[model samples]
Target: MRVIAGTAKGRALKAVPGTNTRPTTDKVKEAIFSMIGPYFDGGLALDLFAGTGGLGIEALSRGIDRAIFIDMDRISVDIVKHNVTAANVAERAEIYRNEAGRALKALEKRGSAFSLIFLDPPYRMKEMDALMLDLAERGLVEDGAKVVVEHDADHVYPETAGAFEQLKYARYGDTAVTIYRYNPVRSEHPMEE
Candidate 1:
């Protein structure tokens, strides 16, 4: 895989050394950025299930000030670190090998709110709703933050997840990507598909 845009546009990223982790394909990644942002202005990003740190690294490259990448597997974490360094974005990244739940708790304690959150958990796990609720309840996401979720096209998440409202949804074969915006103000807007 490679950085598709921004400062690290062509930088190559190494995948996790096994079949357990699936890296986001360039096509889907491009589509995701198109939905939320093809670029950003200086905000923090969180990659809760960082397979190769691609999403978070992409965020950083596109202008996010900093990013935190968390993955449960050791090999994934190591690859994320190496990829971050290779992209020359190590200074703006924080990578850790921790499960989603624990990592959120620790991020809560650290007191950093993210403006962008990427959740691309394994297809078999259906915890996106719960995880979104956790982020809202813990104030881990800043108001107006955008969350990008990648999942099986057959599985549909709710129109709303806690403080986030669905903004966009698109399907590419078996993979589906949804974008949500944190609207603590409870504003109304039509969901796009």
Candidate 2:
């Protein structure tokens, strides 16, 4: 797949050879960025369960200050590193060869917070809720930061989780994109105390 916009626009990215990973389509990427708009300037980003690193790379190309990509598969991590270097955004990127949950915990320990977080795990994994809860508990997402999750359209997500509020959801064939934002004020006073 190719980057849809920004500095790396039109650049080709290498994809994983097997079906273990699913790269986001150009159309979906375009739609996602369109929804995100131009607010990414200098923002920190995180890519969970990152496959080819396409989504995170797109954020970097669009002017995000830095991005951290996490993926457990060695092939996927290598592909992401190669793609980042090829796109000339390696200086603004970091890759971690670890599972999503462990990576999130480690990032929390580092006291790193992201303005944007992308979650695109395998369709049948059903790990989205657990990951979201962990992120909430660990404070990995900055206040007002947006989290975009890609899942099978048929999958159901929790209505709410801690500080995160579901902003919008859209369907593209079998895939569904859900956007969430962390609101500390609301979460800190659940009963308006």
Q: Model 1 lDDT vs. the true structure? A: 0.91
- Backbone collision tally, model 2: 0
- lDDT tens per residue, model 1, 118-181: 9999999877988998998888989999999999999999998766889999999999998999
User: Candidate 2 at 189: error in angstroms?
Assistant: 3.1
- Computed on alpha carbons, the lDDT of every model, listed in order, comes to 0.91, 0.88
Least lDDT summed over 10 consecutive residues: which range in candidate 1? 184-193
**TM-score: which candidate is best?**
1
Q: Which runs in model 1 stand beyond 4 Å of their true positions?
A: 187-193
- Residue 36 in model 2: shift from native, Å? 1.7
The stretch of ten residues in a row with the least summed lDDT in candidate 2 is 32-41
Candidate 2: give the clashing pairs. Answer: none
Per-residue lDDT value at 8 in model 2: 84
